[model samples]
Target: MRLLCLDLEVEDKGGFFAYPSDFVELDCSHKPINQISTIVGSSNGLLCLTHRYRNDSQYQYLYVLWNPSIHKAIFLPVPDFRLNSNRHYALSHGFGYDPTTDDYKLVRVVYVDGTVPPQVEMYTLRSGGWGYLTASGPANVIADWTLSVFMNGVVHWLAQTPNGEGNIRNVIVVFDIGHEEFDEMPVPKSLEGMEHLNMEVAVFHGLLALVPCNGNEWELEGEESYSIWVMREYEVVESWTKRFDIDVGVGLRRVVGFTKNGEVLVIKGGKLLSYEPSSQEIFNPHIRSRTESFYFSTYVESLVLLNVEDGE
Candidate 1:
């Protein structure tokens, strides 16, 4: 697995993250230079990043599709809507590769007035521009920090449905990039009727899963519990199963992703750790990162984009 982190300085420079046992300052010489950006998602060795700026107090946003393994990138042209008088900036984005078209695409939804439905847009790599999509969008709030998980040419995010005046029920919002369509799927039944729960979509064994945060169990004492519900069959709610219940001597806040050998990696109190369920041994991967300064996610290194350039 790989990770991305910011350089200690303000300049947008840092190295590729490789987890080591000892806690040491990671080196940055190997990473490509970048702007301070939030990672919207990553797939097929491609990373989607968005950087927001203010020029004379006017909002400016830039989107980039980068291949860290290739150390190359392509800057996306601004969507037409954002350039209009309305300035319909995107509130969330999803990225995926469409095998059917042999292309990469981005899906974003812009927030307008609360009463106004979100304006959806689709960005195709070959097209190099964003076009409006009329696909169904979230009915209620979508957590801003929920980075989408791309799998099987689909992007998924944790979303919600309004239950009452101010309450909501959790659900998963799916976007089929190849088809340019949107759909909603039921979350694990265990998560149903949960108003105070927080969750995120994660890729588990190449399938979609929900990482439900057991925040109440997280503390300095007692055995803490962590759970993930894996969808054995895509788009089938009945197939959702609790694949694992991790009991750790220490507390953990999140299960971001998994490692190559199936070790579950988690973050708690700002440190990255790995738990081998078979051995029940937790070890520090020491993925040196300064949380306050950088955005990060796990990835697998590849030379895909370079091959694309070579073919071109």
Candidate 2:
């Protein structure tokens, strides 16, 4: 299996400020045919990527690439789409290859100039055309910028709803791919104070898992606080159970991905921690380096680890 980490630098005025780099390329048996941007592991051990390039205006394009074997990467151009200067914007969110359909899909949450409605554009790899997915919620629910998580052939994202007076409620929006329908998923009871924490969602072991960071409290005390909630069954909004709660004294972070053996790998401060849900045992790899981003695959492969120094 092969894994890769990408370091992205965003420029500011006099100097450059470093943000968290995007995680790309998961562990897989298939070797990439060429160096392609936005590589992601598709279901059934396939490597999917797009030839993405940035223009002077900062827009991006998606060109599909595949490596049937380890030696070469094949670039496939969709019929209707052109690689010209079309102001195409590329997003890593909500883009993955679905094994069931054997098609790559690209979903982006964007805003149009004349409309107040938030729009979701979907592009299928096989058809090479764009379709609009209907969305339901307040105008501001979809974040102007946020990542989209795909689970069970559906895409999920966090949105906001304006309550009475001036308050707002954070809700989960789900889009079903098969039916092309939109629905809402109830957040876990434990997600009460989600606005105050850094949270993310992923599918683990045929279940949905939520990870939340402890924020300034953990930063000041040098402690880590995180929890993992697993969905007991599919499509049952409230069927979630807390699997594990991690409290590593000051300097540890939660694992962002799973190991080939199904162990949940977390990082604390600068160390790696693994938790096996079946055994409820936590193991430390003791790697004394800070990791910026991580991705996992179903097999063991050399992981693309990243380390960054303070920018000047």
Candidate 3:
């Protein structure tokens, strides 16, 4: 329950540059910094980053907690779980702060060979170690590349679980940070069988929101609109409501999360676009990338990890 002061800004120059107020581009020319695997999640201004590198014949990954404002970082120790070279695995991560314990926690779920009940582990800042969770995870495989939203001390993921008829369906997997419990919530009834399309759980205007598009941008030949669904009340399945529809038209690649002012950040072709719901207009901040690759996360500047030492 660590309260975050949203929209606070700071000036600092480094590998990551904030653009149009939200997106940041990594400067790969920086050594060691280039190893950032993914910008997993953020809480209280501390970023959870995974660094992957090749050690001799094996690959190794280290989790880093960093506060760009203070230029301080702490590298977490390797988890007790060992990689099985014979099998392939996919990793999903969630980060948040538990105000009850006054600790920051990182949750990692490893799916070995696309199997269910994935191996789950957590790293607590105060404990300074990683511990394995014994609970049985959701039977569904959490969607790769889908976004996870942290709200009200819980992290929600969009996953597709198989139904009784062997057909895949979408479900919201919930993980409570303080209790370290796993649970499942049903998605809006309209999106039940549409798991094939791109969908994500996002926070809109202080409520848990869902954004689902009709088709992938590359596959759509015509215009398409995305539906914004928000839960009027937390944990109340019946409270889910379709707030509005955003018509992004053609070449809308992805919905890149939202801005503090409630504008929708999206990707179109090779540029970043912001759509304002009230005005029903789209504005380009003139941000472009040669590769058309963008990673979006709401960043805040603080001194959360300023006291942590390396390798602690």
Candidate 4:
């Protein structure tokens, strides 16, 4: 897993380091924050970042399209949404590239305190603007901590929908970049009724992989395990298969994402560890951090957005 390491030490200037062998510092000196608040997603060597800051009474968010390889970036304009200080708001985003149109699109979903339907918008890099989409988002509740994963030109998220008894159940919400439409996919039957299960989405071997992180939050120490479910066929309910069940012994604070080579990246004892599914062996890369949590994604260096106009 290529890491984008952020230094959280107060004594030094906060910056990012692309890790493993080469300690190269990707420049963010052009922006005021000089640090990326959130990495939404990356595709074709282009990264989508969000920066949030408070302005007097309310928080303002700025979206950026950056290509570190060429050190070029474009800051997108703010959306047409009102931010009332009294009302609570949660924002979720997904970024991907559309090969059909040769465009990079960023999706934003705004949920207001779980009372109103989510407002969905799409921002295309070529057009350089945000447009409200007809799809208001899934007719279900998106899990608060679920991160969006882009695979096969569709963005996926874990959501909750009400069942017959007015009970909430877990489901998958997907949005196509080409069609610009939203659709629903089914989780494994074993996981459908398990609404309390801590689940996450990932891509494995060119297929959608759903990981159920057992005992991540609700289980006792030394009993945490991860079960991977891979959808062999796209959009097919029955193709879900149980791939691996890894028992990570102890001190597992959280399950990070997966590596490009199919190794699972996990956190144990404030250090980064990689677990190879085939060998079932745990290897520590010796990445230690003082920060309590980490934000990471699989990355590749590319020249995307290098030729685009830099709207600074």
Best of the candidates, TM-score: 4
**Per-candidate local distance difference test:** 0.65, 0.48, 0.69, 0.70
How does model 2 fare in lDDT?
0.48
- Give the winner by lDDT: 2 or 4: 4
Question: Tens digit of lDDT per residue, candidate 1, span 161-199?
Answer: 643446567778778887788777898776765766556
TM-score per model over all chains: 0.77, 0.60, 0.82, 0.83
Distance (Å) between predicted and true CA of 44, model 1?
A: 2.6
lDDT of 1: 0.65
Candidate 4 lDDT, 124-180, residue by residue in tens: 988878899985666767664567789989999877773444766778888899999
What lDDT does candidate 1 reach at residue 128?
Answer: 62
lDDT of 2 by residue, 27-72 (tens): 3223222332443334333334443455674555454433322322
Best by lDDT: 4
lDDT of 1 at 77: 72
TM-score of 2: 0.60
Clashes of each: 0, 14, 1, 0
Q: Candidate 1: give the clashing pairs.
A: none
Q: Which residue runs does candidate 3 get wrong by more than 4 Å?
A: 1-31, 53-60, 162-165, 213-225, 290-300
